[model samples]
Target: MRITVLVTAKRNPDLDGAACAIAYAELLREEGYDAAPLVDGNPDAEARFALDETGWARPAVSMSASEIVLVDASDVVGLPDAVSAERVVEVIDHRQHHDAERLFPRARIQIEAVGAAATLVAERWRAAARRPRGSTALLLQAAIQSNTQRLRGSVTTPRDLDAAAWLAGIAELPDGFVEGQFAARAAEIVADVDAALSRESKRFDHPEGSYVVAQLELPGAVGLVDAVAAADLARTERVMVNLVDVDSARSLLLIWDSAFRRWVAARLGVTFTGAGAECSPAVLRKQIVARLRGDAS
Candidate 1:
């Protein structure tokens, strides 16, 4: 069967979105299917998740026209509407409530708030005893390590840990390789106020609706400027934004035009700081949705 794999993610190569797409494509090919990876945006760009490399020509235009589209969950933001709803499928992901059912009711949706989708992919590989060789294994390993935050993120689960251990054994990585990878990723974040404020921001979906989680990743020291900017940005972005400095681990939640934020704040007993800004969270959410719809926002 003709299958097209679409991997979507924020424009960051350091992320694991592209690697996950490649891993998925390899698995599908082994299953006797014609599978190719199609990433959103310019394949030759330097941005994150971009597919720029020699011999990596633009994927055949017909690839997207295939009968099946297996999307990397991170790439969900860049999905096109031309494909049939029945053909769209998703790999495991950390994204919370999404509009997947409405867009692709036939999609084999698999969402897990765990370490990384690569862990699930690895599980599938082990179950099938389909050993990946050389580059494929390396790529998958990098993806798993990166997504797990080097086994430090709160999302890391037992399944993720088991998968990592198994993959490490099979891949036989050198000492400190995994730790080095995590350190490199962490170092990419700038130490400025923007970077600090952006670090804690996340996106999630709930039955009531979807919202953005903004947190601050600060060192132990609290700065008034960083805190103020984070609160302003959260309001301007229009989603429920929370700020937390990694050092203090203190978090501030700002819900837009809803009592939920207050309730959460009170329940958590964390004082809500910062003057509310004028940005609309609904607008920001809509923008994100539009981007996922393949509209250039």
Candidate 2:
């Protein structure tokens, strides 16, 4: 029972990762490829919200596939052992750290500096002279908006804006779709802090130590910093909680273990208060991780 091609998101996937995988799989299927989306880990709150709102089917985990197409991320660190470089047939990524051409030299690589991987997926769909329908269009649109913070994020590119606009036009969604989605995600996080944090956190194992980076956007900043679920991720060697107030475009960072906190503070040249540090102009979790790896683009 050999599967031809399987598309998967990196472990601890968020809305962008999961949506891009599913949407890209749809594109592959439309092109007469036997493709299916597989989730490497449980979906986070934002991903769950997208699935629920868009009504897209939940993806299964099993993968007995001959080839793999990775979306949203291209790093081997977060992927399963089964996904080797040879098995990788394609990779669509938006981050700077991944060199798909270098890692999977024979694979079809599309690594751009766009705000979201979904933007690239949308571009591919358009390039094929096809339009995504219903949930596919909605999910891709939502992914671009979420990743780019409704085109207000520092990393947002013109490609992302155009792709999102095209998707919204096809879906017949209102211009305020992003605001509604952002509000809903924040409400979901506020309703259950522990569930939200655990779902959003992604773990990384480095030469120095292992750590978890958790992030969630809120409607507002009130009472959010104190409500972070740092203790829930006790298994992690260190924890970094990013609390974003979407309404104000502000962010706060909370770190556990004084040594790690101090190290991060020194790196950013910020005050290491016992409470939490404010990240002015608000950086996303992806940006923070990139900075840590010295791969910020």
- Best of the candidates, TM-score: 2
Write one digit per residue (lDDT tens) for candidate 1, span 252-293.
344554465554444333444443322211112223333333
Note the residue pairs that clash in candidate 2. Answer: none
lDDT (Cα atoms) of all candidates against the true structure: 0.49, 0.77
Predicted candidate 2 versus true structure: per-residue lDDT over 225-273, tens digit per residue: 6666345653344788887766666677887667788767776666756
Q: What 10-residue stretch in candidate 2 is worst by lDDT?
A: 228-237
TM-score of model number 2: 0.78
Q: What is the TM-score of each candidate against the true structure?
A: 0.63, 0.78
